[model samples]
Target: MRAAGRGGPVTRAAVLSAALAIVDRDGVEGLSMRRLAEAVGRDPMVIYRHVPNKAAVLDGVAEIVFAQLSVDVKDSDWTAQLRVIARDFRALALEHPHVVALLVTRPLATPLGQRPPAVVRPLEDILTLLTQAGFSGETALHIYRALFGFLYGHILNELQEVVERPEETDEVLRLGLHRLPVNEFPLLRELAPLLAHYDGAAELERGLDILLNGLAATL
Candidate 1:
């Protein structure tokens, strides 16, 4: 019943998936080796065989989250590829808001090169896309950083705006926008109807067009 580094790679993957399920349902805080084992029907001690520690579990969860992003760079031009990747990434983050928090913050805790391969692959793909499209090594990294930074920022902003908000009401008062001082925030107050129907994907597309076009024109 105890897994002491005994599970093979497939077993480890299954354990990681179970860990992800726990994160989706209960958030990262609710994920413990014991909890993972319980979710996967293993002894609490057994999960450690698959994952060395809590840190590894978190990293594995991050790896699993990253793996969900499927970007097809081969089928399109650089701009189109990037658009697909950007939209796919934002969609995945929205799908798993709790796991996305881990995805966004884990880089602070672990170095990029030292991260798991799955976790690092998306960056590598982007860098490849840029290099193939004529960006030099240094320029590619810079562009990747700028692009990913905006993507990450957009994901966080979207989560904050949409995650905890109540179901749409016909009126803005239900969104608590009515609480703001009308004089101090006249435009935002007046735009409540538009804000009530926030479309993150559309805004992200518009912003990306600006960012990517600006990059193209600049470089």
Candidate 2:
């Protein structure tokens, strides 16, 4: 896939897209310059020429994932905007479960932090929402932390579910119910069905509402 490097060489976007496809199929561990080269029908050296190394490749994947989120705070209500952002993020993570673990553990400052310009716009929108809601810069930062923590936690839990049990059986639900003594955890057992059900979008919207409402009351 080594395009002529004279005038306009292989664009970064093309390289990143190929990398994301690799991650989606083979996961972060399965990724390597050689594998990426084979997937893209390029020489391994050409892959390196576009991205400095494998770490950079992983970062590109993260950027690609974030780029998929569509949130516009200027056009939507602050709470509505935040809910959309959270939901979109949750969906993206779930779509690429293999990459979720890498995203959680990797520091943003690493390759991931070098996000494409498109990724920064969504964060700027979120920050703008927080400011409009009467939060100080510090408080806005804290809100951001809480918002992401909730999203990440939800995605991580979903990833665990996929890994531990590929099949969703009634027995799985019963095991969780058994952990809570019926006498002491009557409410929990009664609500087990709702609790066991996985709806990342709905849960994300609910959590966002709670977080924004809490922030509103505090502010």
Candidate 3:
């Protein structure tokens, strides 16, 4: 549906694209129907014609981001394909850190059948990848769940390592780990140096190694 604006007819894609920009700039909290209408240069009431409400707009924004994740269903090496997908997914999350929360939490709120098609496509494609590689549908589904569960955890963990004092030379000060009592949080304080230099890509590869190796053994 196109909402007639002063400049031209704003397609639903245009409306959602504007919504995505708002989310990318100010995050999910900043997005509202009113702001979206302004972004698209339309009346606030006109937004209702494109999307029913803020929830719908939020879902559309998520779909726009998730659409970037590509799946190679034809890749015969299921494990290798999964590794590539995992890395690509990680890159996508890092590229749009603000959208990471939605990427992780939206599924919990949305039932499988109710989720946006783009959000669900990766799952379907992965299932196809595994099943085509000789795994049963049930097992493929389990692998899919396990892989994504690990990914979600990894991404959230990666994004949470915010450096409080980047300019500080001391690792503890840099990570604000020194704020915790040295005696009480001995282990955490001791690891401050290691924590300060987080290598998200290396960490992701390590996790994929462990997870994929373990999953491979079962097959």
Q: Highest TM-score, which number?
A: 3
Backbone clashes, each candidate: 2, 1, 0
**Candidate 3 CA-lDDT value:** 0.86
Give the residue spans of candidate 3 off by over 4 A: 1-6
TM for every model, in the order presented, reads 0.86, 0.77, 0.92
lDDT of 1 by residue, 69-183 (tens): 7656464487788888898888888778888878888756987678988888887888888887888988888887888899988888877874224664644564676677888
What are the lDDT scores of the predictions, listed in order?
Answer: 0.79, 0.69, 0.86
Best candidate, lDDT-wise? 3
Model 2 CA lDDT for position 213: 93
Of the two candidates 1 and 3, the one with more favorable lDDT, higher being better, is 3
RMSD of each: 3.7, 4.3, 2.3
Model 2 per-residue lDDT tens digits across residues 93-145: 77888878766655456553455665565666677777876677788778777
Query: What ordering of candidates by lDDT runs from best to worst?
Result: 3, 1, 2
For model 3, what is the error of residue 86's alpha carbon versus the real structure, in angstroms, after optimal superposition? 1.1
Q: How well does model 1 score by local distance difference test?
A: 0.79
Clashing pairs in 3: none
